[model samples]
Target chain A: MIRIDQLIKRYGALMAINGIDLHVPAGELFAYLGPNGAGKTTTIRILTGLTKLSSGRAALNGHDIEKETLAAKRQCGLVPQNINLDSELTVSENLDIHGRLFCMKPVARKAKINELLTYVDLHERSKSLVKQLSGGMKRRVMVARALMHSPRILFLDEPTVGLDPNIRRRIWSLIKKIQQDGTTIFLTTHYIEEAEFLADRVAFLDKGRIVAMDSPIKLIAGLGNWAIDWLTDDGMQTAYFPSRTAARESATAKENGFTLRRVNLEDAFLSLTGKKVQ
Target chain B: MMHGIIAVYLREMLILKRRLKRQLSGMAISPLLYLIAFGYAMGDAVQFNGHTYLEFLIPGLVAMGSMTQSFSIASDINVARFYWCIFEEFQAAPISNFAYVTGEVLSGMTRALLAIIVILALGLPFGVVLYYGPLFWLAAILNSFVFASLAVALAMLVKSHADQSLLTNFVITPMAFLGGTFFPVDRLPMWAQKILFLLPLTHASKAIRAVALSEIPDWRAYLVLPVTGVLIFIFALRSVKHARD
Candidate 1:
């Protein structure tokens, strides 16, 4: 569980994370969605105690991050935006070092490493150096490293930025499995589809502020708008939606050949941010 | 508190073998060349504190090696921020500040030791006298540990790679040279002695050189080691703590 209240972060004259509140309940797959420079990473950095908060309070499982950093940090595993791993070390060695950071016993760490390597399908590469691996392999290794400590809460900042689509999908499925295992999952992504497919609830952050927060379906429904489309010899004509019902009613009154569809995250994102979701 | 430090220590020693080999060629070998040319070529002129010039220079070279080594290991902290891509791992881990600082100190000590051995081995027959054998090595390690902590603290104080390198060139290099690696501190002007007293490398070289030369070993040199060690350790600890949380 996590609670963030009125968090304010400033850099010179610019406010990075303006006064904002956020809550994540146990066993939830929560997605933090924002574009570049939307303060998503800053918020997660504060939670992990890697960066100092300018003001306000953040708690992890009832322990304030600033005051009880060790306790808070012990319960969380962070997979940074970039693969933050030791390239020179073997897969098992990577997990070993991470486990030791939390003071995990050698015997316990060995077992954890094996279990994680297997879970991420990297057991065969246990003795291989990270630099010898491909991009997808490295991502899996990073995931395995995070799970080595058996953290109760996992914060993944763009865990699938440049991976192949197959690997990204595999990662999402693994994330779902992790949530099913009862670890609270907090993630940030620029990919709307990722948030939609994996997130139980997604918070859309724009310019350091959360403009909307809800499940994907609910968020799209909240948009209350829809688009009707007709493919002609030239191109597809897409209509705007402030009302799905109205859009549907219009579809009934259209040129009699248009396809009417329910509004989805892509549509909702465009409606909310005034730009097509990339 | 020391577990994280041990993890870092192990990682550096085991995974950085290639880098160590490279550094031995660069920092260790470059100075050993001086020991070679000067030890045999200029056998006539270089003497200090009552010993052959080569004898005086070899131990001094050992001290110099340790100082540069300890300082270079400190540079890895900055490297972690830039390329190794693992700085955030340490930053986010729940380890005590003591562990990180200790790891840096130990790595620096290791590098210093590496450089010292190679330089000593290369300068063996040139008449560089090493009097205290095992104890000399012990003092060398301790001296390096203290200097390493000081170097790491200062390295962390800077931000970018260029800035860190400039500091190493301008600050660490000057400290190594003026701290009496090539000459006795007594020979310097009395005013400069005041400044040398303020630098850890001065005491480090004094302590290490005393042992390498096998003299009775100055009690002043012995007293300076632990005091300077604790001071630098505290400064490093505070800086890491402030940076982390």
Candidate 2:
């Protein structure tokens, strides 16, 4: 569980997170969607105790991030946006260090390392140095490393960035499994489809503000069930219709050829903020 | 807090253990060259304080080696911060700033001790035996603490690896050469001696060299090392906090 109230983060003259409020109940998979520099990462950073908040209050499972930093940090595991696993260390060694940092007992640490390595399907590669692993393998190791201490909440910041679609799907399944195992997941990602497929609830953030927040299906439904996309002199344009027949009718009315497709989470985001998730 | 310190230290020790062979060779090369080039070349031709030049140079080399090797932890910290992003991982963890600083400072001191051991072993082939009493080790540890703490502080402040290198060139290199390591600070001009005396390594060199020669060292040198070490350690803690912010 996490709670944030009127959270404001300012870097000199620029606002990184502007007066946002959020509460994620335990065991929910929450996706934060935004384009580059849209404050998604900033919020995650603030929650995980990596960066201090400029103003307002944030708590992790009832521990204040500022006052009870260690306790708050102990409640959450963060898979950072960057590939930060120690390259010179083995995959298991990376997880071992994380376990140690959280003060896990040696026996518990070893067992958990083995369990998580297996969970991520990298048990055979545990002895391999992180640098020797492929990108997908490294990402899996990061996931396993983050889960070593078995924190109740997980913060995944762009966990599948730069991975191939197949690998991304694998990571998505892993994330789904993590949520099913009763861990609350707070995710920030640029992939709209990722949010749609994995997130129980989605928040679209833009320019340091949340423009909309709801279930992905509900957000899409609110924007209508079908969409007609056409290329115009001005650029690509899209219109949404409640029914496929209405969408087809709208497509036929177009001056040029058009495309008819189901309205997706990205369309909901674009309809609200007039910007691509990215 | 203790657990946090042990965990951080354990990570460093694991890495050090993995690269022990490379690190040992690196530790030996510089001291060996100094001993052969300066010790054999001078070879009792120069004497100071009723000792052969080789004898005098060994302790000086120990002092300098401790300073350089201890301060070298900064490069490792910079590599972790800039390349591996390991420091960020530590920041995200539950470790307190004090625990992180203590763990890193201890690792740096360990490296300094290992380097000092290599230098002493290298001195044995030349048949230069000296007292390595508790006082001598105290001075060595205190010296390492001062430089290692300074290293952590500067590593946090530097924006990039190049900036860290610039710091070494400007700060550690000059101290290594002029801090009574190669020759007596007293032999220098009065003004130069006064400036070098301000350096913690100069006091460390004086204290360590005196202990090795079985002489009562100036108490002020012992006092200066820990006082400076504690101050720099506190600064390192603040730097870590500032970095987190």
Q: Identify the leading candidate in terms of lDDT.
A: 2
Model 1 C-alpha lDDT per residue in residues A70-104, reported as the tens digit of each score:
89998899988887788877888888988888899
- Model 2: what is its DockQ? 0.81
Model 1, TM vs. native: 0.91
Tens digits of per-residue lDDT for model 2, B1-245:
98889988888898999899999999999989989998888887888978998888888889999998999999999999988888989999998999999999999999999999999999999999899999999999999999999999999999999999999999988998999888989988999989998999899999999999999999998899999999999999999999886
What DockQ does every candidate get?
0.57, 0.81
Q: What TM-score results for chain B in every one of the models?
A: 0.90, 0.99
Residues A218-272 of candidate 2 have per-residue lDDT tens digits of 9999888999999999999999999999999778978889999999989988888
**Docking outcome class, model 2:** high
Over the full model, what C-alpha lDDT does candidate 2 score relative to the true structure? 0.93
Q: Which stretches of candidate 2 lie over 4 Å from their true place?
A: A253-256
Tell me the docking grade of candidate 1: medium
